[model samples]
Target: MSDAQNTESPASENPLSAWSGRTDGDAPEHLRWHQVVRVAEDAAHNDADRAGTALIGFASDEGVRRNHGRVGASAGPAALRGALSSLALLEGTGALVDAGDVAVRLGDDETPGDLEDGQAELGRHISGLLDEHRLVVVLGGGHETAYASYLGLAGSGRVGPNTRVGILNLDAHFDLREAPLPSSGTPFLQIARDEAAAGRTFSYAVVGVSEANNTRVLFDTARELGVRWMTDETCQTADVTNVRRFVRDFVQDVDVLYLTIDLDVLPASVAPGVSAPAGFGVPYEVIHACVSEATESGKLALADAVELNPGLDVDGRTAKAAARLIHTIVSRHRAG
Candidate 1:
């Protein structure tokens, strides 16, 4: 990636200008994320320990368009940041660093940018950030963000042929589609193939799958690949004992974990602003429990929340939900 593509520089205007909220006080306890966040460039120059959360934005919807889904998820990063900015901060939440965005620029003729190149660029940035920050949270463009996230982990020098890495996806659909090219619906399968080529084990699990949404062939493919999953109906029970156990077992079995949240996993009534809202989705409490369980495991290295289409949002409800999940992932994350 070129230096021109990296917008995290301090000399540039603050990319987090969206991070504005009421100022309660100058003290740490009174501060919100906006008051505490610094640009990546600023963080690098400072003497403070780089032991906090680093946020990067993937501003591309090319994958979603290719998957024949709604096209507005490209704007998810800014919307998430806006939602997160005003949230109250706790004493030990650690420093927040905004690493700016890896954006897909449009051509003069208005054609879409290359999704493959954008994912590759995002991987390079994520790999670099993994070395400096305790936790790296990618604010996403679409489900394709997960594949780029996988690239970052593969290149971070932490995983090898023998290392067991787990991927936990929270979504209403199984994104294991067969396609001529990569798209929002094909990332997990791409990861599986990539892992196989590298002689690594592909440990993947999905929660909140909608049986009616995914075809039988997809289910057969998932089973053939040894993917573990729980349906939306299964996750809707008031008790989360099974959910906790499912996440706990996955976390225990892998040396490292990557958690990805697709907002469509939640009921459409709860999260209407997604490329494809769920007709029968997992409840918010169940999803929250899953995230909390994963982050508390100490093996979580990277996490992302994707598929928030601001154009379809109802009063920013989806953004708020996504932000809440992100907040939990960052605040509770323990580096492996």
Candidate 2:
């Protein structure tokens, strides 16, 4: 089915809102976290607060449908907002803002399906936020969000022919598909091509690749492109020292870092809501450590948690896991 067939409403309608949630507490005098947090227009970024974090949601799964995966990742943004609502504002949480979502535009016969267009819109917003000097934490519609996030990074005017931008992806698959159309599995390759065209180097590395999930061609693609990766077999608690070493080296090399986490990289026990759940995914604790180490490096320019399909979620574990990771990266970014 086409992407236009998946949604019940038109794409341009704003699917975001001023975030409101539970506020039950023992004493009114006690400090409550949400009071300080900003939402919708109030959360809109400005130069006055360079140390704040802004939230943007890419609420489209058209790429996933084109990739032939399960649907419903478009619901992820709302799920993330709900999951993060009641959490405490930890030290280094930073000033927060919600910029709402960039959703899919259901196409008619007169208009062609354009998921790329939505991605471009997201890129513009991401660029605007970065221009304002706010750290961006994007909520995803699918792993496809990576391409748009990449655009946002490039949009910042930070990249040039002699310069390089580092991309650190945590995923079970390389997502370097050579497809005629852009899909969730094709963002990285698209980024590579775009960088090459712009006379820039695409410095990419993946953590948590599953041999069972990726074909031999994908492996060759990774090798052919000189992409560095640590397999799922090596991303264990026992191997964390090496994992940290790999991440630290990657973090130190980039002028600006784009961190993308495809949630399917986590063990299925911890995240079963994704379109492609991993049978033997990397452990969450290990992923957390890698993310924490990277964020703490202070070079992480932007980050996103992708592929939480709430339609298949069991007990909300997957959304919770994604939210925890988001919290960790954003909090740590603030602390740094």
Candidate 3:
């Protein structure tokens, strides 16, 4: 049963698996990682000693959020994998594993149930993966994965002095919208409530969301809970020097920091493949600055780069940019 023998699952043997192969052959050539991304036949299970950092491209398009079709981001995982796999970070000493995409049923052109199915399935699968890896690089499927990623890591571990969780979300939407009963838009709300019921504390923060996109209701909820964040405009207007210092100072004693980047936070010019594009955003350089600064600060236990829609991408621009961000993170910590 172990992956050592390298046997394919019965699902892989099906003709449909081969029949419905990837049509995205046009990966970015300019980037180093895309050229080398392998279609991993085996879901990566690394030796604990060999485990450097793990990036699981969790692909799911179905979600009942506000704008599903407007942003074609389900293709995020595969596209990003192509970019990350090709990188030779720090002379190839980093151990990177492409935990294959988590499959979700994308509904017909218009259907709410299908999206919920995708969100639920993603939550279950990602929860299992968190048990294994120290660092998880999540390529967009949707913001739903953030709550899934958070809940997965939060569910098992009891918070001790060593246990800490900090959230940094970069997106135009607050994603704090009330769960419309039960759907993708409400994962974080549900997660926060669930964690509270379980006698746990989940401290979160968001970046990039503007007042117009995120209603005052969500802000009030977040503020009441003590979840602090820097808005997209704040991040954009501030000098990188001051922002880096702010980010470093903000996450000083954090044992686990979960970073969520919604592609919508990026300007449409640089990254057009976002479901929710914002007019203003922090320059990617500032994100790099904060991440690099954080590395020197303390333990960056968990991070997920979410929300890039390859189906909506122009010249593979966003994918490449996100890939470089991944490289910077890996290179920052990867052994040369």
Which sequence of candidate numbers ranks them by TM-score, best first? 1, 2, 3
Question: What is candidate 3's lDDT per residue for 211-324, written digit by digit as tens?
Answer: 767778988877877776777677764577767766666676456666677767777787777776567766777777766765545455556667777777889888888877
Expressed as tens digits, the lDDT of each residue in 1-336 for candidate 2 is 113333332222332343456666635343234545565355444544557787888877788888889988989988987787766666656677666777865333355357887888788778877765558888998998999999998978555567668999999999999997888999999999998888887799999999988999999998888899999999988998899999999877887788999999999999999999999989999999989987888778799999999999999999999988988887778423
Count of backbone clashes for each model?
Answer: 0, 0, 6
Top-lDDT structure, candidate number: 1
Q: Which pairs clash in the backbone of model 3?
A: 32-86, 33-86, 33-87, 34-82, 73-309, 140-307
What TM-score goes with each of the models? 0.94, 0.89, 0.78
lDDT of every model, 2 decimals: 0.85, 0.81, 0.58
Best by TM-score: 1
Off by over 4 Å in 2: 1-18, 24-33, 43-48, 106-112, 334-336
Considering TM-score, which of the candidate structures 1 and 2 is the better prediction for this target? Answer: 1
Q: Candidates 2 and 3: which is better by TM-score?
A: 2
Error of 2 at 263 (Å): 0.4
Alpha-carbon RMSD, candidate 2: 4.1
Best-first order by lDDT: 1, 2, 3
Candidate 3: 10-residue stretch with minimal lDDT: 10-19
lDDT of 1 at 52: 85
The per-prediction CA RMSD against the true structure, in angstroms, equals 2.7, 4.1, 6.3
